[model samples]
Target chain A: MKYLEDIGSYFLMLRRTFSGFTKADVLRELIFKEINDLVMSSLGIVSFIGFFVGGVITLQTALNLTDPIIPKELIAYATRQSIILEFAPTFISIIMAGKVGSFITSSIGSMRVTEQIDALEVMGINSLNYLVFPKVIALLTYPFLIAIAMFLGIFGGLIAGVYGGFISLDEFIRGLQEDFIPFHLVYAFVKTYVFAFILATVPAWHGYYMKGGALEVGKASTKSFVWTSVLIILANYIITQLLLS
Target chain B: MIEVENLKMRFGSEEILKGISTVFEQGKTNLIIGQSGSGKSVMLKCLIGLLKPEAGIISYHNKPTQEMNLNQQRMLREEIGMLFQGGALFDSMTIEENIMFPLRMFSNQSRSEMLLRVNEVLSRVNLDGVNTKFPAEISGGMQKRVSIARAIVNNPKYLFCDEPNSGLDPKTATVIDNLIQRITHENNITTIVVTHDMNSVMEIGERINFLKNGLLVWNGTQEDIFKTKNEDVTDFVYSSNLFKKIRDVQNS
Candidate 1:
């Protein structure tokens, strides 16, 4: 029953988050600020994780293919498929559910705790729009970040497959171009956009409706991370089934 | 002027405000004084349009708040300023940015003009040259002053403060109280303060409403507060001996 109520409140929060606009000038400034905080600050870690994880996937794939009958090119192909189809979009998002999600929850939750949200409402600003809409618009660039992650993941795989002596550089390049489907990129980005919205809004709901003091803000951030990861994984399953099958 | 007529509010089978009706007039420091759990904060929240009452009327200059649409409510809220008990400054923004927040959100003033107004209010609050500092960088008393600066920056018609001096020294608390009262008179703003501090009550209680357990038990000026013989009145008086000393001095 509580879960059902939370879902209901989530939709209501979504509706309000996009309901009306505040001053465009203020929103523009807020949007840029959010972009810096949410997107730009996240690039370094996303790139690092995407690169290292891709390298590990390549090494693991090469080590498992002990059967000399298997061609070395399949390692590169498997790495490409893993990076683009799942790691870049879904895995990175789950990571962000911890990083960006906690940030949003704590920031907004602290505002709620300290009555800054109430101050905004008293000042006649739509607090949700003023707070969450900028985040939504800012995370519109989430897919762009995912695109960078995809590129970095593949490059890391290339470096690992060749220098680690798992496969020749030429074979890795050839496998990357092997029967590559354009729709998979489309499919990946479609999921990224959906995940981006989930990333921005779910944490916002937790933060905006949260009650209590500073301790509750920390608890709310943890709750936001848990819920965002759960929802993202759930979404990944649903999207993959609908699109891939 | 703000008028509350038979205002009733409740939360989950328990009524927090049991039919409160009163008037808070312009150019006076109207105080709502009660002990903890007396619904003082809830009443302030209601007055600021943050919470809607379950019944009765909250009318601003004869326009009922319940009747206002979203646009109308926004318009009304734009004219209202509030100071939370904790000084609720935006942690991320500097003091200047905090005070300029309302102007940036509501007005289309140029940057220099906004800065000028920000400096004007900061200086009025006696917080000069602290614009670049964040809320965490300031003392509690200065934070309350900055809260006041932010509240009156836009020249709001109604100013509501929830315990303006919760954690300050008595000297600083009196400074804040006097500042609020003076602003009330200078701007002729309809100011309502919710507090339990007898010092606040005695210092700026131009028109005071003494609430007890969700009910209005006594209403009078600060002078009248000492004169009343009612048990509820004397009960609150005995709770704080400042008035007793004044009463003794007067009798002598």
Candidate 2:
């Protein structure tokens, strides 16, 4: 009975957090800056990882497609699918989980343990609305920035292929243009939204329920990163199957 | 004014608060005093909605807390200011920012107006020139003062201090106690303080509630406390040699 009640309260709190996300003032003040930072601040690391992975996947896919049964155009197709649907959203959210998710959890968890949340509540401020909503809203919107990173990553692959003399710029461009599908892009963007939600919610929930002193705040931060990363990967695969099949 | 009626709180099998009840009148410093494990803090938490009680109701005025919705509960909470035991100021923010936090969160005050209010509260707590200093640069007593400034910045109707003097030196503790008393009187707010310190009980115990094993054992004014015949209350109060000597000298 107690466990059921706890679950019920958790859902209620989650609903409260979501409703808070819908407020225009909160979005304007808090979430906008967070989205800008999550997208802009992480650009360097995402670009660095994106370029290297893009090069490797391109090399491997090109070498395998040398068989007469497979068309050389298939390499570009596979790269497009991987970069948009998987690499852009999943890997970027994983990196974000390390950076932004950990920050939210630690800050909120410490506030919880230290009675800052209590202070807010006593002041008639909705602690959940004030603390959690902006974060969720920012995270929900930040993935569009990662979609841009996907373009850059694929561009890096084309550059690497041209530099290595595996494929000419004109050939790569032609392959990409011919292989692109509108539905794939839509599917990829939708996947990013889900990844962002998992990344934001898991960490926020962990931080919200935190108890004890500084040690517990540390624990919540570490757990937020670990669980968010795991959930992102698992979610990526499930979404892939659901979308494709 | 606040009234807790037959409040019971439990953590699993451990009953941290058992059938505790008391009233804290407005415009006075009301104290809840007990040993460390005697459930004083738990009762405070229960009153403030940090912890939910398994039984009984806490009322602000005559409105039962259990009857209020989340927003109404939040409204009641907003009418409160709390000085945490650890002086839990936000580390990333400076003293000015820390003091300005509640005003920013709960009030529609503009930046300049918020700064003016922050300065006023900081001056009230004697933290005039150190507005930009981080919490690390301040002493424990100063941190408590900053916490006090933050608490009062919103001009709350109820002020809760959880061990407001816990780690301060004697002089600092007195400063915090005096500050709380002064703030209570000035604002005419119902202030409830939870502590184990006899100094606090004597200094600001306009009304004191004694809790023994999670029960309200006695409630009275400081003068009434000195005249009480209850052994438990006397044993708790006169346990210190300084208090014992004072009691002996007074009797003589």
Candidate 3:
């Protein structure tokens, strides 16, 4: 029953977020700020994680395939496939579910605790639209960030493959181009876009409705991360089943 | 003027406001005073439309709140200003931006015009030349002043303050009380303040409503506070040694 209530409340919050739009100027400023906070600020950590994880994938693939019959180019092929299909999109989103999700929850939850949200409402502002809509719009840049992660991941794989003696540079390049499917990129982006919406709204729900003081803000952040990750994983499974399987 | 009739509020099984009704006059510092858990805050919230009463009529300028259409509700809310107990200033914004917020949202004033009005209110609150400072950089009293500045920046017709003196020193609290009183008188705005501070009650409580356990036990003015023989009002008002001494001196 509690789960059902949360689900119902989540949908209600979404409805409120979509209705009673703020002025375009205010929304534009908020969106710009969110883009800077959610997308731009996240670049360093995402790139670092993408590069190291891609390199690890390459080394593992190279070590596992000990048979000479298996061409060395297969190392790059495996790395590229893993990074594009799952690592860059799904894993990076999970990481963001921790980083950005906690941030959204804590910030909004603090506002709730401090009566800032109430203040907004008391002033005739649609608090949900004012607070959450910008976040959702800013996260439209999520696919773009994932694209950067994809580039760096493959680049990291190339460097690791050549330097770690996993495969020659030319061979790795050939493998990257060997079985490239246009649809795979499309599939990844579709999932990225879906995950992006989940990222913005799920954490917002936890924070906006949270009760209590500072300690409750921390607790809401943790709960937001858990629920966001769970929803993302579930959505990933459902999307993969519908689009790829 | 604001009038509340038979206002009742509850939290699940717990009743917070038990059909309390009172009138807060225009151009006066109307006060709601009670001990903690006496439903003073709950009554204030209900009056402000932040919490809907389970039963009652809250009429602003003779228009019932529940009967107002969406646009009317918006317009009504715009005409109302609130000062929270904790100041509730947006931490991310500087004092100037905080003061300019309501104008930016609801007015057609240009940037220069908004800044002028913001400056006027800042000066009105006696908080000049700290516009660039964030809420955290200022003292609690200054933050309360900023909150008041923001509340009145749009020139609201009604003002509600919840424990406006909660964290300030006695001296600063008196200053805030006087400031609120002056603002109310100057604008002829209907102001309602919820507080338990005897200093605030004695200083600017032009009309005072005393609540005890969700019921309004006494209604009178500052002069009447001393002359009235209401037991609850006497007990609550003279609970402190300082006020008791003052009361004794007055009698003597």
Candidate 4:
């Protein structure tokens, strides 16, 4: 019953947040700041994780192909499939469920604790639209992040495969092109956009409706991370089943 | 002026405000005083339209608040300025940005015009050259003054303050009380301040409503408060040795 209530409240909050925006000029500035905080700052960690994890997946696939008939090209194919289909979209988002998710929760949750939100309401400002909408717009750049992750992940796999003598550069490149489905890119980014909305709204719901003090802000951050990750993973499964099957 | 008629509010299982009806007069520093948990804050929230009451009529200039649509309510709120108990300054913003926030959100003033207005209110609050500083960089007293500056920067027709003097030294608290009184008189705005501090009552309480357990037990001026025979008001007013001695001296 409580979970159902939370879900209902979450939709209501979304309606208010997206209904009518306030002060477009000021909101433009806020959107830029959010882009810097939420998207730009995340680039470094995402790149590093994407690159290294791609290499690790390549190495694991190479070692597993002990049968002689299984072409070395199978390695490049497998690594490409893993990174594009799963790692870039799903894995990186779960990472951000901790990084960006907690950030959204704590910043807004701290505002709730100090009565800043109440101050906004008393001033006739739509606190949800003013605070959360900018984040939602800023995260429209999220698909860009996954695009970079997709490239870096495949590139890292190439480096690892050729350097480790698992496959020649030509063979690996050919393997990457072998039976490559054009729609997989579409499927991956579709999941990213959905995950992006989930990332912005869920943590904000926890922060905006949260009740308590500083300790509760911390608790809300933890809850946001858990719930955001759960929702993202669930969304990943749902999107894949619909788009692929 | 603001009027409340039979205002009532409740949480899940408990009522916080029990049919409170009172008038906060225009151009006066009206105060609601009560013990903690006596619904002082609840009453203030209700008056500001932050918390909708279960049963009551809140009227501004004879317009019932419950009848106002969202746009109408927002227009009403635009005329209001509030000073929260904690100052509620935006942590990420500088004092200048914080004060200019309402202007930027609701007005078409150029940045230069807004900056000039911000400086004017800062001077009114006796804060000079602190615009570049953040909330965390200032003292609690300065922060409260900045809050006052923000509240009045737009020249609101109504002002509400929740515990304006809490978490301050007595001397600083007195300064805040005087500042609020001066601003109230200068703008002739309807102002409601909620506090339990006796000093605030004595310093600037032009109209006082004394509540005990969500009920208005007494209503009078500061002078009338000292002379009232109501037991609840008497017990609350004279609970301190200093006020008790002052009352005894008055009697003699």
lDDT of 1: 0.91
DockQ (CA atoms), all models: 0.85, 0.41, 0.88, 0.93
Give the distance in Å from residue A169's predicted Cα in candidate 2 to where it truly belongs: 1.8
Best by DockQ: 4
Off by over 4 Å in 1: B241-252
Error of 2 at B34 (Å): 0.4
Q: For model 1, how big is the CA root-mean-square deviation?
A: 1.3
What DockQ class does candidate 3 belong to? Answer: high
TM-score attained by model 1: 0.98
TM-score, candidate 1, chain B alone: 0.96
The digit string of per-residue lDDT tens for model 3 on A123-201 reads 9999999999999999999998899899899998888889988799999999999889999999999999999999999
Give every collision pair in model 3: none
Error of 4 at A192 (Å): 0.4
Q: What is the TM-score of each candidate against the true structure?
A: 0.98, 0.90, 0.99, 0.99
Question: Whole-model lDDT, candidate 4?
Answer: 0.94
The global C-alpha lDDT for each of the candidates, from Candidate 1 onward, is 0.91, 0.83, 0.94, 0.94
Model 1 Cα lDDT, one tens digit per residue, A144-237: 8899888898899889889998899999998888879999999999999999999999999999999998999999999999999999989999
Q: What is the lDDT of residue B114 in candidate 1?
A: 96
Which should have the higher DockQ, number 1 or number 4? Answer: 4
| Candidate 4 local lDDT, residue A92 | 96
- In each prediction, how many residue pairs overlap at the backbone (N, C-alpha, C within less than 3 A)? 0, 4, 0, 0
